[model samples]
Target: MPMAAEEIEAMIRAAIPDAHVEITDLAGDGDHYAARVVSESFRGLPRPQQHRRVYDALGGRMGGVLHALQLTTATPDRGV
Candidate 1:
């Protein structure tokens, strides 16, 4: 089954309570998505670590129900 953008956002929010998440459906298919996640928790993390946090929030759905995710993560202090 394909993942819904709402579900993705919910998962992220659940894990990172202070995050601001934006999810877009690219290719008009639920399988491909673009997510922009901003949180205070990411303030000191490297880019790779930031991405891993969001991926972890997905609960191992990255290559399964959620096929492709073009993720951009940032901290609110960075003006994202």
Candidate 2:
């Protein structure tokens, strides 16, 4: 089953308590999503590492129950 946007946001929030997560259903099909995650914890991390954290929050759902996520990460101070 494809994951819901709420589920994605909840999972990320659970992992990163202070993260501001915004999820958009890119295809309107519940499978392809675009997520923008902003958090203080990501301040010093590289882009790839920041994305890894969000992926980790998904608990291995990527490419399985959840697919095609276009992720963007940033710190609160450096909005993107």
Candidate 3:
């Protein structure tokens, strides 16, 4: 089954409590998504590491039930 946007946001929020998560369905198909996550927890992390954090929030659903996520992450102080 495909994952819902709210579910994705919830998962991220669960992992990064102070994160601001915005999820967009790129293709109007539950399989593709674009997520912009802003969080204080991302402050000192590099881009790849930040993405890794968001992925971890998803709990290994990235390539299985949820596919093709274009993710952009940033700290609250640094706009990306």
lDDT values, one for every candidate = 0.94, 0.93, 0.93
| Candidate 3 residue lDDT tens string, 1-80 | 99999999999999999999999999998999999999988887789999999999999999999988999998887654
Model 1 segments more than 4 A misplaced: none
lDDT of 3 at 35: 98
Error of 3 at 34 (Å): 0.2
TM-score quality measure for candidate 1 = 0.96
Q: How many backbone clashes does candidate 2 have?
A: 0
Ranking by lDDT: 1, 2, 3
lDDT of 2: 0.93
Instruction: Quote each prediction's TM-score.
Output: 0.96, 0.96, 0.95
For model 2, how big is the CA root-mean-square deviation? Answer: 0.9
Which residue ranges in model 2 land beyond 4 Å of their true spot? none
Alpha carbon lDDT of residue 76, candidate 1? Answer: 94
